[model samples]
Target: MFPLGDTHGGRIPPLNQILQTVQQNTDSLKTYISAHHEIAYRSIQQHNAQLAMFAEAAKLQSRGLEQFLVSQEKANLHIREIVGLDLKALAREKQAELGKEEMEKREPMLRNYVHALADFVEVVGGRETQSQNGELNVAASVATIKKAEVKPRVWRRG
Candidate 1:
């Protein structure tokens, strides 16, 4: 009257064999997790490196802009000096004028002054004469000339 289920042979698989199988599976899983973790870490490192590089580039751009502004200031000063000298010369010539012959001689000087003033305006103001739609604006050129007269002198030797 032995138990029917355990009648023939009550032998189970060896404990050592079961444990070996479990260890092999665990090692495989460990290898997979380690590999995944390594990949994720490398990806994060690369992303951080890219962000650092971008930040450095932005800093360089800002420095470049600062340098450009300083250069523009210097150029404005030079332009002012040249324009002042030209205007003074024109005034002196006009003051010394006697008749129509003097006026005739001064005409070319006046034209030169006008051209120089226009150039100065274009350099100082951020206005562009060329339209995006390709239409020329004659009024813009006149406005630029008037604008030059009102611009503060960058060079005033005190």
Candidate 2:
């Protein structure tokens, strides 16, 4: 025989060594999985935090826009009120100017009318004294007075 036991037979590892190696590999795998889980968890948390920040920013932007619109509406209403008041004041000023112009124009015509009426009265009285047509002349004078007393019609646009 070459040897009593086979050569290199005792070089094989024991069962405890194999079991320890498998346990070490399992522990390493668990550690790797735990590290990956931590990384994924942190990523999810960061994403959620970013989403929350964006949502808050959007809310703030919406509120700011609403406030801006409200302020603009208020400004526009104020401007309209100012414009309305300005228009009213301008209308009143124009009305006063037109009244002054109408008065200035009517004054001279009224004076001329008074002078003509005086001359007509003097002539009519003289004619009445010199003629026997007194009744017709008085009737004509009364008719003229009636015509002068009538009010002039004024037309206005609605």
Candidate 3:
């Protein structure tokens, strides 16, 4: 394709608010809203699709909020110590940002979120199964996994 013009169609056409263009934009917006409503506004039932969707959104939003903290803490923050989970600094920062009155009002909801987030992270990432001491936790007789290769003797006995 020559830079001059592979085809005149590729060249920028004059911007116009034609009916077809308007209809396309409307269709796309409706689709987007429909999808969001399906994931976020559905009635809770025997299955928790809405909760799962909100949980995933929370993880993404948490990372985004991390960028806005006035002073980001380098140390890991624990949202709940009993879980022994290390969460992003923003988790602690956001909880602290709530006023004393608001915190009291939201205590139960916050507790439930902390517990759910820990369990979700553990299940999805499989991190909980690994021992905190850097060893695999299993009931098998096998002791340790030997990932490193056994090198050949430097001076072989011929």
Candidate 4:
């Protein structure tokens, strides 16, 4: 290779050679710095994109939760409407009316039930305490005698 400039007594390079080396180093440093800057910029943009996606997901979740809460509140209001605002006051207001209505509705059914229960008891009591013309009534099993003696055998473990 042909030398661009000779070093004086091999102690110091020429001024032009020194300047060229410095310029090359400076150019490499600039290139390296620019490459790193581009990488960092791209990384920041990707992070922002990901953050935006996450934010949108969070917003959707928040909206869904809000809708759920609204529905729950509506359901509570509907139940309150069905049940009334003050149950104690309502019960107090309806006590006499409900009692009279319930008694009127159940009186005939209760009477029939009592009559049926009395008839059932009478039939059951008559069957349980049966008498045949003032004579004693006995079960056939109790009246029959066992001519053959029954002996229960005990099993022994061998």
- lDDT score of residue 111 within candidate 3: 49
All candidates: TM-score: 0.52, 0.48, 0.23, 0.49
Q: Count the clashes in each prediction.
A: 0, 0, 0, 0
Each model's lDDT: 0.53, 0.52, 0.42, 0.47
Error of model 4, residue 41, in angstroms: 0.2
The model with the greater TM-score, 2 or 4, is 4
Backbone clash tally for model 2?
0
lDDT (10s digit) by residue, model 2, range 1-158: 12223543656566686788789999999999999999999999999999999999999999999997776655544433332332223323443655755635544533444345334444444331333243344445435533443211221210
Q: Clashing residue pairs in candidate 4, if any?
A: none
Say which candidate scores most in lDDT: 1
Model 3 residue 35 lDDT?
Answer: 92
RMSD of model 3, in Å? 29.6
In model 1, the runs with Cα more than 4 Å from the true position are: 1-12, 77-89, 92-100, 105-158
For candidate 2, the per-residue lDDT at 123 reads 49
Judging by lDDT, tell me the better candidate of 2 and 3.
2
TM-score of candidate 1 on Cα atoms, chains taken together: 0.52
Global lDDT of model 2: 0.52
Of candidate 1, the 10-residue stretch with the lowest lDDT total is: 128-137
Error of model 2, residue 112, in angstroms:
39
If the candidates were sorted by their TM-score against the true structure, best first, what order would they fall in? 1, 4, 2, 3
User: Top TM-score: which candidate number?
Assistant: 1
